[model samples]
Target: MTTKLLIGLDGQSSGDRALSFAENLAKLIGTAELLVVYVIEWSPYSFQTPEENAERHKRREEEISTAMERVVTPALARLEAAGIKAQGMVRHGNVADSLDSIAAKQNASQIIVGRSTETGLSKRIFGSSTANLVMGANVPVTVVN
Candidate 1:
Protein backbone atom coordinates (compact mmCIF):
# COMPACT_ATOMS: atom_id res chain seq x y z
CA MET A 1 0.00 0.00 0.00
CA THR A 2 1.21 3.49 -0.81
CA THR A 3 1.73 5.81 2.11
CA LYS A 4 -0.29 9.04 2.23
CA LEU A 5 1.82 11.81 3.76
CA LEU A 6 0.51 15.07 5.21
CA ILE A 7 3.10 17.82 5.54
CA GLY A 8 2.34 21.04 7.39
CA LEU A 9 4.02 24.07 5.83
CA ASP A 10 4.21 27.33 7.79
CA GLY A 11 5.60 29.62 5.05
CA GLN A 12 8.92 29.78 6.90
CA SER A 13 12.45 28.73 6.06
CA SER A 14 11.97 25.70 8.29
CA GLY A 15 8.92 24.77 6.21
CA ASP A 16 11.13 24.63 3.12
CA ARG A 17 13.36 22.23 5.06
CA ALA A 18 10.34 20.09 5.88
CA LEU A 19 9.39 20.03 2.19
CA SER A 20 12.86 18.83 1.29
CA PHE A 21 12.68 16.23 4.01
CA ALA A 22 9.31 15.04 2.76
CA GLU A 23 10.59 14.83 -0.79
CA ASN A 24 13.51 12.68 0.37
CA LEU A 25 11.26 10.51 2.48
CA ALA A 26 8.90 9.99 -0.44
CA LYS A 27 11.76 9.00 -2.67
CA LEU A 28 12.94 6.48 -0.09
CA ILE A 29 9.50 5.10 0.76
CA GLY A 30 8.16 4.96 -2.84
CA THR A 31 4.61 5.52 -4.13
CA ALA A 32 3.76 8.17 -1.56
CA GLU A 33 1.13 10.90 -1.96
CA LEU A 34 2.00 14.28 -0.46
CA LEU A 35 -0.55 16.67 0.96
CA VAL A 36 0.93 20.08 1.74
CA VAL A 37 -1.13 22.18 4.14
CA TYR A 38 -0.59 25.81 5.11
CA VAL A 39 -2.53 27.44 7.90
CA ILE A 40 -3.22 31.16 8.31
CA GLU A 41 -4.14 32.26 11.80
CA TRP A 42 -6.92 34.84 11.71
CA SER A 43 -6.80 37.49 14.38
CA PRO A 44 -10.05 38.87 15.80
CA TYR A 45 -8.55 42.23 16.65
CA SER A 46 -8.31 43.40 13.05
CA PHE A 47 -11.67 45.13 13.09
CA GLN A 48 -13.88 47.40 15.20
CA THR A 49 -17.54 46.40 14.81
CA PRO A 50 -19.00 42.92 14.31
CA GLU A 51 -19.87 43.64 10.68
CA GLU A 52 -16.47 45.17 10.09
CA ASN A 53 -14.88 42.15 11.75
CA ALA A 54 -16.70 39.80 9.40
CA GLU A 55 -15.64 41.81 6.36
CA ARG A 56 -12.09 42.03 7.57
CA HIS A 57 -12.05 38.32 8.22
CA LYS A 58 -13.32 37.65 4.72
CA ARG A 59 -10.72 39.93 3.15
CA ARG A 60 -7.94 38.42 5.23
CA GLU A 61 -9.08 34.94 4.35
CA GLU A 62 -8.87 35.75 0.66
CA GLU A 63 -5.49 37.38 1.11
CA ILE A 64 -4.22 34.42 3.07
CA SER A 65 -5.56 32.01 0.46
CA THR A 66 -3.76 33.91 -2.25
CA ALA A 67 -0.56 34.07 -0.21
CA MET A 68 -0.71 30.36 0.45
CA GLU A 69 -1.23 29.73 -3.24
CA ARG A 70 1.78 31.86 -4.08
CA VAL A 71 3.93 29.99 -1.58
CA VAL A 72 2.72 26.48 -2.43
CA THR A 73 2.73 26.92 -6.22
CA PRO A 74 6.50 26.71 -6.45
CA ALA A 75 6.72 23.90 -3.93
CA LEU A 76 4.10 21.89 -5.76
CA ALA A 77 5.82 22.55 -9.06
CA ARG A 78 9.09 21.35 -7.58
CA LEU A 79 7.47 18.20 -6.24
CA GLU A 80 5.94 17.46 -9.61
CA ALA A 81 9.26 18.13 -11.32
CA ALA A 82 10.73 15.52 -8.99
CA GLY A 83 8.02 13.07 -10.21
CA ILE A 84 6.23 13.14 -6.87
CA LYS A 85 2.43 13.20 -6.57
CA ALA A 86 1.30 16.16 -4.45
CA GLN A 87 -1.60 18.48 -3.56
CA GLY A 88 -1.89 21.79 -1.75
CA MET A 89 -4.35 22.92 0.94
CA VAL A 90 -4.76 26.30 2.62
CA ARG A 91 -6.70 26.49 5.89
CA HIS A 92 -7.50 29.24 8.39
CA GLY A 93 -7.28 28.55 12.12
CA ASN A 94 -4.90 27.86 14.95
CA VAL A 95 -1.90 26.10 13.43
CA ALA A 96 -1.79 23.10 15.76
CA ASP A 97 -5.51 22.30 15.67
CA SER A 98 -5.71 22.84 11.92
CA LEU A 99 -2.77 20.55 11.27
CA ASP A 100 -4.16 17.84 13.56
CA SER A 101 -7.54 18.00 11.87
CA ILE A 102 -6.08 17.93 8.37
CA ALA A 103 -3.83 15.00 9.20
CA ALA A 104 -6.72 13.02 10.65
CA LYS A 105 -9.04 13.88 7.77
CA GLN A 106 -6.42 12.81 5.25
CA ASN A 107 -5.69 9.60 7.19
CA ALA A 108 -2.04 10.46 6.83
CA SER A 109 0.45 7.63 7.25
CA GLN A 110 2.96 10.24 8.42
CA ILE A 111 2.77 13.90 9.44
CA ILE A 112 5.78 16.16 8.83
CA VAL A 113 6.37 19.54 10.45
CA GLY A 114 9.26 21.92 11.06
CA ARG A 115 10.72 22.75 14.44
CA SER A 116 10.38 26.43 15.33
CA THR A 117 13.27 28.44 16.73
CA GLU A 118 11.11 29.64 19.59
CA THR A 119 12.52 27.84 22.59
CA GLY A 120 13.55 28.32 26.22
CA LEU A 121 11.92 31.39 27.83
CA SER A 122 10.07 32.40 24.67
CA LYS A 123 8.68 28.93 24.21
CA ARG A 124 7.56 28.80 27.81
CA ILE A 125 5.92 32.23 27.69
CA PHE A 126 4.23 31.59 24.35
CA GLY A 127 3.73 27.90 23.74
CA SER A 128 5.21 26.76 20.48
CA SER A 129 2.65 25.57 17.91
CA THR A 130 5.13 23.02 16.60
CA ALA A 131 5.58 21.60 20.07
CA ASN A 132 1.83 21.51 20.63
CA LEU A 133 1.27 19.73 17.32
CA VAL A 134 3.93 17.19 18.14
CA MET A 135 2.14 16.29 21.36
CA GLY A 136 -1.42 16.55 20.04
CA ALA A 137 -1.13 14.88 16.64
CA ASN A 138 -3.00 11.60 16.37
CA VAL A 139 -0.48 10.17 13.91
CA PRO A 140 3.27 9.90 14.17
CA VAL A 141 4.90 13.28 13.59
CA THR A 142 8.30 13.71 11.94
CA VAL A 143 9.76 17.04 12.97
CA VAL A 144 12.45 18.52 10.72
CA ASN A 145 14.81 21.15 12.04
Candidate 2:
Protein backbone atom coordinates (compact mmCIF):
# COMPACT_ATOMS: atom_id res chain seq x y z
CA MET A 1 0.00 0.00 0.00
CA THR A 2 1.18 3.49 -0.78
CA THR A 3 1.87 5.65 2.24
CA LYS A 4 0.37 9.12 2.30
CA LEU A 5 1.95 12.33 3.52
CA LEU A 6 -0.24 15.20 4.63
CA ILE A 7 1.30 18.58 3.94
CA GLY A 8 -0.24 21.62 5.64
CA LEU A 9 0.14 24.78 3.61
CA ASP A 10 -0.18 28.37 4.82
CA GLY A 11 -0.12 30.02 1.35
CA GLN A 12 3.24 31.58 2.13
CA SER A 13 6.96 30.97 1.77
CA SER A 14 6.71 28.76 4.84
CA GLY A 15 4.27 26.59 2.91
CA ASP A 16 6.62 26.46 -0.03
CA ARG A 17 9.36 25.09 2.16
CA ALA A 18 7.05 22.43 3.53
CA LEU A 19 6.09 21.42 -0.01
CA SER A 20 9.71 21.27 -1.05
CA PHE A 21 10.60 19.06 1.87
CA ALA A 22 7.65 16.78 1.26
CA GLU A 23 8.55 16.54 -2.41
CA ASN A 24 12.02 15.36 -1.58
CA LEU A 25 10.76 12.93 1.03
CA ALA A 26 8.18 11.54 -1.39
CA LYS A 27 10.88 11.11 -3.99
CA LEU A 28 12.88 9.11 -1.49
CA ILE A 29 9.93 6.95 -0.53
CA GLY A 30 9.17 6.15 -4.22
CA THR A 31 5.61 4.94 -3.65
CA ALA A 32 4.41 7.73 -1.39
CA GLU A 33 1.49 9.99 -2.36
CA LEU A 34 0.83 13.46 -1.03
CA LEU A 35 -2.29 15.25 0.12
CA VAL A 36 -1.74 18.99 0.30
CA VAL A 37 -4.15 20.77 2.63
CA TYR A 38 -4.77 24.44 3.35
CA VAL A 39 -6.81 25.34 6.41
CA ILE A 40 -8.45 28.71 6.86
CA GLU A 41 -8.76 29.51 10.55
CA TRP A 42 -12.41 29.46 11.58
CA SER A 43 -14.29 29.14 14.80
CA PRO A 44 -17.66 27.53 15.52
CA TYR A 45 -18.34 29.36 18.78
CA SER A 46 -19.56 32.63 17.32
CA PHE A 47 -23.24 33.44 17.97
CA GLN A 48 -24.98 35.20 15.09
CA THR A 49 -28.39 36.35 13.92
CA PRO A 50 -29.99 34.71 10.85
CA GLU A 51 -28.72 37.44 8.51
CA GLU A 52 -25.30 37.41 10.07
CA ASN A 53 -25.11 33.63 9.80
CA ALA A 54 -25.99 33.83 6.13
CA GLU A 55 -23.23 36.34 5.55
CA ARG A 56 -20.76 34.17 7.43
CA HIS A 57 -21.64 31.19 5.28
CA LYS A 58 -21.17 33.28 2.15
CA ARG A 59 -17.77 34.44 3.35
CA ARG A 60 -16.81 30.86 4.16
CA GLU A 61 -17.65 29.82 0.62
CA GLU A 62 -15.61 32.72 -0.73
CA GLU A 63 -12.64 31.78 1.43
CA ILE A 64 -12.79 28.15 0.35
CA SER A 65 -13.03 29.19 -3.30
CA THR A 66 -10.11 31.56 -3.00
CA ALA A 67 -7.96 29.00 -1.16
CA MET A 68 -8.69 26.28 -3.71
CA GLU A 69 -7.95 28.65 -6.57
CA ARG A 70 -5.03 30.65 -5.23
CA VAL A 71 -3.32 28.12 -2.99
CA VAL A 72 -4.28 24.45 -3.40
CA THR A 73 -4.56 24.36 -7.20
CA PRO A 74 -1.10 25.77 -7.81
CA ALA A 75 0.41 23.38 -5.30
CA LEU A 76 -1.21 20.43 -7.03
CA ALA A 77 0.11 21.63 -10.37
CA ARG A 78 3.59 21.86 -8.96
CA LEU A 79 3.42 18.33 -7.61
CA GLU A 80 2.15 17.09 -10.97
CA ALA A 81 4.98 18.83 -12.74
CA ALA A 82 7.40 17.14 -10.39
CA GLY A 83 5.86 13.74 -11.23
CA ILE A 84 4.59 13.15 -7.74
CA LYS A 85 1.24 11.46 -7.19
CA ALA A 86 -0.76 14.00 -5.21
CA GLN A 87 -4.09 15.71 -4.43
CA GLY A 88 -5.15 18.87 -2.58
CA MET A 89 -7.77 20.03 -0.08
CA VAL A 90 -9.02 23.37 1.29
CA ARG A 91 -11.01 23.48 4.51
CA HIS A 92 -12.24 25.95 7.13
CA GLY A 93 -11.49 25.14 10.75
CA ASN A 94 -8.92 25.36 13.50
CA VAL A 95 -5.69 24.62 11.64
CA ALA A 96 -4.23 22.02 13.97
CA ASP A 97 -7.50 20.21 14.58
CA SER A 98 -8.47 20.22 10.94
CA LEU A 99 -5.11 18.89 9.86
CA ASP A 100 -5.15 16.16 12.48
CA SER A 101 -8.69 15.15 11.48
CA ILE A 102 -7.72 15.00 7.82
CA ALA A 103 -4.63 13.01 8.68
CA ALA A 104 -6.75 10.45 10.47
CA LYS A 105 -9.37 10.36 7.71
CA GLN A 106 -6.77 9.94 5.03
CA ASN A 107 -4.69 7.43 7.03
CA ALA A 108 -1.64 9.50 6.43
CA SER A 109 1.50 8.21 8.11
CA GLN A 110 3.04 11.60 8.65
CA ILE A 111 2.19 15.30 8.53
CA ILE A 112 4.61 17.97 7.35
CA VAL A 113 4.15 21.66 8.10
CA GLY A 114 6.40 24.69 7.82
CA ARG A 115 6.95 26.88 10.83
CA SER A 116 4.79 29.99 10.68
CA THR A 117 6.33 33.02 9.08
CA GLU A 118 4.51 35.40 11.36
CA THR A 119 5.71 35.89 14.90
CA GLY A 120 4.66 38.40 17.55
CA LEU A 121 2.87 38.78 20.84
CA SER A 122 -0.20 37.07 19.46
CA LYS A 123 1.68 33.97 18.32
CA ARG A 124 3.64 33.89 21.54
CA ILE A 125 0.47 34.15 23.60
CA PHE A 126 -1.60 31.63 21.66
CA GLY A 127 1.17 29.36 20.38
CA SER A 128 1.57 28.36 16.75
CA SER A 129 -0.45 25.74 14.85
CA THR A 130 2.73 23.72 14.43
CA ALA A 131 3.26 23.62 18.15
CA ASN A 132 -0.33 22.59 18.70
CA LEU A 133 -0.19 19.86 16.04
CA VAL A 134 3.07 18.52 17.31
CA MET A 135 1.56 18.27 20.73
CA GLY A 136 -1.77 16.73 19.78
CA ALA A 137 -1.41 14.80 16.54
CA ASN A 138 -1.65 11.04 16.42
CA VAL A 139 0.58 10.89 13.38
CA PRO A 140 4.15 12.10 13.41
CA VAL A 141 4.62 15.74 12.35
CA THR A 142 7.67 17.05 10.56
CA VAL A 143 8.34 20.76 10.76
CA VAL A 144 10.17 22.34 7.86
CA ASN A 145 11.86 25.67 8.30
Candidate 3:
Protein backbone atom coordinates (compact mmCIF):
# COMPACT_ATOMS: atom_id res chain seq x y z
CA MET A 1 0.00 0.00 0.00
CA THR A 2 1.15 3.52 -0.77
CA THR A 3 1.88 5.73 2.20
CA LYS A 4 0.01 9.01 2.55
CA LEU A 5 1.18 12.30 4.04
CA LEU A 6 -1.38 14.88 5.16
CA ILE A 7 -0.38 18.53 5.40
CA GLY A 8 -2.25 21.42 7.01
CA LEU A 9 -1.85 24.65 5.06
CA ASP A 10 -2.79 28.13 6.25
CA GLY A 11 -1.73 30.07 3.12
CA GLN A 12 1.09 31.73 5.03
CA SER A 13 4.88 31.69 4.86
CA SER A 14 5.11 29.08 7.59
CA GLY A 15 2.61 26.98 5.66
CA ASP A 16 4.83 27.29 2.60
CA ARG A 17 7.74 26.02 4.64
CA ALA A 18 5.67 23.10 5.85
CA LEU A 19 4.69 22.25 2.28
CA SER A 20 8.32 22.42 1.19
CA PHE A 21 9.29 20.09 4.01
CA ALA A 22 6.46 17.68 3.24
CA GLU A 23 7.36 17.68 -0.45
CA ASN A 24 10.96 16.75 0.25
CA LEU A 25 9.93 14.10 2.75
CA ALA A 26 7.41 12.64 0.33
CA LYS A 27 10.03 12.47 -2.36
CA LEU A 28 12.49 10.90 0.04
CA ILE A 29 9.98 8.29 1.08
CA GLY A 30 9.24 7.39 -2.52
CA THR A 31 5.72 7.13 -4.00
CA ALA A 32 3.96 8.47 -0.90
CA GLU A 33 0.85 10.48 -1.74
CA LEU A 34 0.34 14.02 -0.51
CA LEU A 35 -2.93 15.44 0.76
CA VAL A 36 -3.17 19.18 1.36
CA VAL A 37 -5.99 20.45 3.52
CA TYR A 38 -6.92 24.06 4.30
CA VAL A 39 -9.18 24.42 7.31
CA ILE A 40 -11.01 27.72 7.80
CA GLU A 41 -11.46 28.16 11.53
CA TRP A 42 -15.19 28.09 12.20
CA SER A 43 -17.34 27.60 15.21
CA PRO A 44 -21.03 26.69 15.39
CA TYR A 45 -21.58 27.63 19.03
CA SER A 46 -22.76 31.17 18.34
CA PHE A 47 -26.39 32.07 19.09
CA GLN A 48 -28.24 33.33 16.06
CA THR A 49 -31.75 34.18 14.88
CA PRO A 50 -33.72 31.48 13.05
CA GLU A 51 -33.23 33.36 9.78
CA GLU A 52 -29.52 33.59 10.37
CA ASN A 53 -29.31 29.90 11.15
CA ALA A 54 -31.33 29.20 8.02
CA GLU A 55 -28.64 30.91 5.99
CA ARG A 56 -25.81 29.10 7.78
CA HIS A 57 -25.81 26.24 5.30
CA LYS A 58 -25.51 28.63 2.40
CA ARG A 59 -22.69 30.51 4.07
CA ARG A 60 -20.83 27.31 4.82
CA GLU A 61 -21.08 26.26 1.19
CA GLU A 62 -19.75 29.62 0.07
CA GLU A 63 -16.84 29.41 2.50
CA ILE A 64 -15.84 25.96 1.26
CA SER A 65 -16.17 27.06 -2.35
CA THR A 66 -13.99 30.10 -1.77
CA ALA A 67 -11.35 28.12 0.09
CA MET A 68 -11.20 25.56 -2.71
CA GLU A 69 -10.90 28.23 -5.37
CA ARG A 70 -8.48 30.44 -3.49
CA VAL A 71 -6.31 28.07 -1.48
CA VAL A 72 -6.45 24.33 -2.08
CA THR A 73 -6.56 24.32 -5.86
CA PRO A 74 -3.49 26.51 -6.28
CA ALA A 75 -1.45 24.56 -3.78
CA LEU A 76 -2.43 21.24 -5.36
CA ALA A 77 -1.50 22.50 -8.82
CA ARG A 78 1.91 23.61 -7.64
CA LEU A 79 2.64 20.26 -6.04
CA GLU A 80 1.40 18.40 -9.11
CA ALA A 81 3.62 20.49 -11.34
CA ALA A 82 6.56 19.50 -9.18
CA GLY A 83 5.64 15.86 -9.96
CA ILE A 84 4.31 14.98 -6.57
CA LYS A 85 1.14 12.87 -6.41
CA ALA A 86 -1.20 15.19 -4.54
CA GLN A 87 -4.82 15.96 -3.68
CA GLY A 88 -6.50 18.80 -1.81
CA MET A 89 -9.41 19.34 0.55
CA VAL A 90 -11.12 22.36 2.09
CA ARG A 91 -13.06 22.24 5.34
CA HIS A 92 -14.60 24.63 7.84
CA GLY A 93 -13.90 23.57 11.41
CA ASN A 94 -11.29 23.46 14.14
CA VAL A 95 -7.93 23.23 12.37
CA ALA A 96 -6.35 20.50 14.44
CA ASP A 97 -9.40 18.31 14.56
CA SER A 98 -10.10 18.70 10.85
CA LEU A 99 -6.51 17.75 9.98
CA ASP A 100 -6.50 14.80 12.36
CA SER A 101 -9.84 13.57 11.02
CA ILE A 102 -8.63 13.80 7.44
CA ALA A 103 -5.43 11.95 8.30
CA ALA A 104 -7.38 9.20 9.98
CA LYS A 105 -9.86 8.90 7.13
CA GLN A 106 -7.12 8.86 4.54
CA ASN A 107 -4.89 6.48 6.54
CA ALA A 108 -2.08 8.99 6.36
CA SER A 109 1.20 7.82 7.81
CA GLN A 110 2.07 11.28 9.03
CA ILE A 111 0.57 14.73 9.68
CA ILE A 112 2.61 17.88 9.05
CA VAL A 113 1.89 21.49 9.96
CA GLY A 114 3.79 24.73 10.37
CA ARG A 115 5.04 25.93 13.72
CA SER A 116 3.43 29.18 14.85
CA THR A 117 5.66 32.17 15.44
CA GLU A 118 3.10 33.81 17.71
CA THR A 119 3.95 33.77 21.37
CA GLY A 120 2.76 35.13 24.73
CA LEU A 121 -0.75 35.32 26.19
CA SER A 122 -2.87 34.66 23.13
CA LYS A 123 -1.02 31.55 22.03
CA ARG A 124 -0.73 30.34 25.60
CA ILE A 125 -4.45 30.78 26.19
CA PHE A 126 -5.75 29.55 22.84
CA GLY A 127 -2.89 27.16 22.02
CA SER A 128 -1.36 26.75 18.59
CA SER A 129 -2.91 24.26 16.15
CA THR A 130 0.46 22.54 15.63
CA ALA A 131 0.82 22.03 19.35
CA ASN A 132 -2.68 20.61 19.60
CA LEU A 133 -2.10 18.30 16.66
CA VAL A 134 1.14 16.98 18.15
CA MET A 135 -0.60 16.33 21.45
CA GLY A 136 -3.67 14.69 19.92
CA ALA A 137 -2.71 12.99 16.71
CA ASN A 138 -2.96 9.20 16.47
CA VAL A 139 -0.30 9.04 13.82
CA PRO A 140 3.11 10.69 13.83
CA VAL A 141 3.01 14.49 13.63
CA THR A 142 5.72 16.76 12.27
CA VAL A 143 5.93 20.51 12.84
CA VAL A 144 7.99 22.29 10.22
CA ASN A 145 9.64 25.50 11.25
Candidate 4:
Protein backbone atom coordinates (compact mmCIF):
# COMPACT_ATOMS: atom_id res chain seq x y z
CA MET A 1 0.00 0.00 0.00
CA THR A 2 1.22 3.46 -0.81
CA THR A 3 1.77 5.82 2.09
CA LYS A 4 -0.05 9.14 2.14
CA LEU A 5 0.77 12.50 3.67
CA LEU A 6 -1.97 14.93 4.58
CA ILE A 7 -0.57 18.44 4.20
CA GLY A 8 -2.44 21.42 5.63
CA LEU A 9 -1.89 24.80 3.97
CA ASP A 10 -2.80 28.18 5.40
CA GLY A 11 -2.03 30.17 2.20
CA GLN A 12 1.01 31.79 3.79
CA SER A 13 4.77 31.42 3.82
CA SER A 14 4.57 28.81 6.54
CA GLY A 15 2.27 26.80 4.30
CA ASP A 16 4.70 27.21 1.43
CA ARG A 17 7.44 25.87 3.64
CA ALA A 18 5.26 22.92 4.51
CA LEU A 19 4.73 22.21 0.83
CA SER A 20 8.45 22.29 0.18
CA PHE A 21 9.00 19.91 3.07
CA ALA A 22 6.27 17.60 1.77
CA GLU A 23 7.84 17.57 -1.67
CA ASN A 24 11.10 16.34 -0.15
CA LEU A 25 9.28 13.82 1.99
CA ALA A 26 7.36 12.51 -1.00
CA LYS A 27 10.72 12.08 -2.68
CA LEU A 28 12.06 10.13 0.28
CA ILE A 29 9.01 7.91 0.59
CA GLY A 30 9.01 7.15 -3.19
CA THR A 31 5.54 5.56 -3.19
CA ALA A 32 3.92 8.27 -1.13
CA GLU A 33 1.00 10.37 -2.27
CA LEU A 34 0.56 13.91 -1.04
CA LEU A 35 -2.93 15.03 -0.14
CA VAL A 36 -2.88 18.80 0.09
CA VAL A 37 -5.72 20.58 1.82
CA TYR A 38 -6.51 24.22 2.54
CA VAL A 39 -9.08 24.92 5.19
CA ILE A 40 -10.80 28.28 5.08
CA GLU A 41 -11.62 29.31 8.61
CA TRP A 42 -15.41 29.47 8.82
CA SER A 43 -17.92 29.69 11.60
CA PRO A 44 -21.52 28.58 11.19
CA TYR A 45 -22.70 29.67 14.60
CA SER A 46 -23.94 33.06 13.50
CA PHE A 47 -27.60 34.16 13.55
CA GLN A 48 -28.86 35.26 10.16
CA THR A 49 -32.01 36.24 8.35
CA PRO A 50 -33.17 34.53 5.14
CA GLU A 51 -31.34 37.07 3.00
CA GLU A 52 -28.30 36.95 5.23
CA ASN A 53 -28.22 33.19 5.04
CA ALA A 54 -28.33 33.29 1.28
CA GLU A 55 -25.49 35.82 1.18
CA ARG A 56 -23.38 33.80 3.58
CA HIS A 57 -23.86 30.66 1.53
CA LYS A 58 -22.84 32.47 -1.60
CA ARG A 59 -19.76 33.85 0.11
CA ARG A 60 -18.78 30.43 1.34
CA GLU A 61 -19.00 29.00 -2.15
CA GLU A 62 -16.86 31.82 -3.45
CA GLU A 63 -14.25 31.16 -0.83
CA ILE A 64 -14.08 27.45 -1.67
CA SER A 65 -13.92 28.16 -5.39
CA THR A 66 -11.20 30.74 -4.93
CA ALA A 67 -9.11 28.45 -2.78
CA MET A 68 -9.31 25.62 -5.29
CA GLU A 69 -8.42 27.93 -8.12
CA ARG A 70 -5.70 29.92 -6.45
CA VAL A 71 -4.14 27.42 -4.08
CA VAL A 72 -4.96 23.78 -4.81
CA THR A 73 -4.69 23.99 -8.58
CA PRO A 74 -1.21 25.47 -8.69
CA ALA A 75 0.10 23.17 -6.00
CA LEU A 76 -1.23 20.07 -7.75
CA ALA A 77 0.28 21.19 -11.02
CA ARG A 78 3.67 21.77 -9.44
CA LEU A 79 3.66 18.41 -7.71
CA GLU A 80 2.62 16.67 -10.87
CA ALA A 81 5.34 18.46 -12.79
CA ALA A 82 7.87 17.20 -10.28
CA GLY A 83 6.61 13.65 -10.99
CA ILE A 84 5.02 13.35 -7.60
CA LYS A 85 1.66 11.63 -7.06
CA ALA A 86 -0.69 14.08 -5.42
CA GLN A 87 -4.25 15.35 -4.99
CA GLY A 88 -5.77 18.35 -3.22
CA MET A 89 -8.92 19.45 -1.40
CA VAL A 90 -10.47 22.60 -0.01
CA ARG A 91 -12.95 22.80 2.85
CA HIS A 92 -14.68 25.27 5.11
CA GLY A 93 -14.42 24.54 8.84
CA ASN A 94 -12.09 24.60 11.81
CA VAL A 95 -8.57 24.08 10.42
CA ALA A 96 -7.37 21.41 12.81
CA ASP A 97 -10.57 19.38 12.79
CA SER A 98 -10.90 19.56 9.03
CA LEU A 99 -7.30 18.44 8.47
CA ASP A 100 -7.64 15.56 10.91
CA SER A 101 -10.92 14.51 9.35
CA ILE A 102 -9.34 14.46 5.89
CA ALA A 103 -6.37 12.50 7.19
CA ALA A 104 -8.64 9.88 8.71
CA LYS A 105 -10.84 9.59 5.65
CA GLN A 106 -7.84 9.42 3.31
CA ASN A 107 -5.90 7.05 5.53
CA ALA A 108 -2.90 9.36 5.47
CA SER A 109 0.11 8.04 7.37
CA GLN A 110 1.02 11.46 8.67
CA ILE A 111 -0.29 15.01 8.91
CA ILE A 112 2.05 17.91 8.04
CA VAL A 113 1.65 21.63 8.55
CA GLY A 114 3.80 24.74 9.04
CA ARG A 115 4.35 26.33 12.40
CA SER A 116 3.44 30.00 12.80
CA THR A 117 6.58 32.09 13.21
CA GLU A 118 5.07 35.52 13.36
CA THR A 119 7.12 37.74 15.61
CA GLY A 120 5.63 38.46 19.03
CA LEU A 121 2.65 36.16 18.51
CA SER A 122 3.22 33.05 20.52
CA LYS A 123 1.29 30.07 19.21
CA ARG A 124 1.09 28.75 22.73
CA ILE A 125 -0.57 31.95 23.88
CA PHE A 126 -2.81 32.40 20.82
CA GLY A 127 -3.67 28.73 20.31
CA SER A 128 -2.90 27.97 16.67
CA SER A 129 -4.68 25.10 14.96
CA THR A 130 -1.26 23.56 14.24
CA ALA A 131 -0.80 23.17 17.96
CA ASN A 132 -4.32 21.83 18.30
CA LEU A 133 -3.74 19.26 15.56
CA VAL A 134 -0.55 18.05 17.21
CA MET A 135 -2.50 17.64 20.40
CA GLY A 136 -5.56 15.91 18.92
CA ALA A 137 -4.81 14.18 15.61
CA ASN A 138 -4.98 10.38 15.62
CA VAL A 139 -2.01 10.01 13.28
CA PRO A 140 1.52 11.26 13.54
CA VAL A 141 1.79 15.01 12.96
CA THR A 142 4.72 16.98 11.54
CA VAL A 143 5.24 20.71 11.89
CA VAL A 144 7.62 22.29 9.35
CA ASN A 145 9.35 25.44 10.40
| TM-scores for candidates 1 onward, in order | 0.86, 0.94, 0.91, 0.90
RMSD in Å for all candidates:
2.6, 1.3, 1.7, 2.2
lDDT of 3 by residue, 84-105 (tens): 9999988888888889998999
Ranking by TM-score: 2, 3, 4, 1
Q: What is the lDDT of residue 103 in candidate 4?
A: 95
Query: What's model 3's TM-score?
Result: 0.91
Candidate 2: give the clashing pairs. none
Alpha-carbon RMSD, candidate 2 = 1.3
Question: lDDT per residue, candidate 1, 5-101, as tens digits?
Answer: 9888877889999999999999998999999888887544554877876697688778777866777777899899999999998877888889899
Candidate 3 residue 5 C-alpha distance from true site, Å: 0.1
**What lDDT is reached at residue 25 by model 3?**
91
lDDT per residue, candidate 4, 61-129, as tens digits? 889999999888888998999999999999988888999999999999999999954445555575788
Angstrom error at residue 69, model 3:
1.5
Off by over 4 Å in 2: 47-50
Return the top candidate by TM-score.
Answer: 2
The clash number for model 2 is: 0
Clash pairs, candidate 3, are none
Per-model C-alpha lDDT, please?
A: 0.85, 0.94, 0.89, 0.89
Off by over 4 Å in 4: 117-126
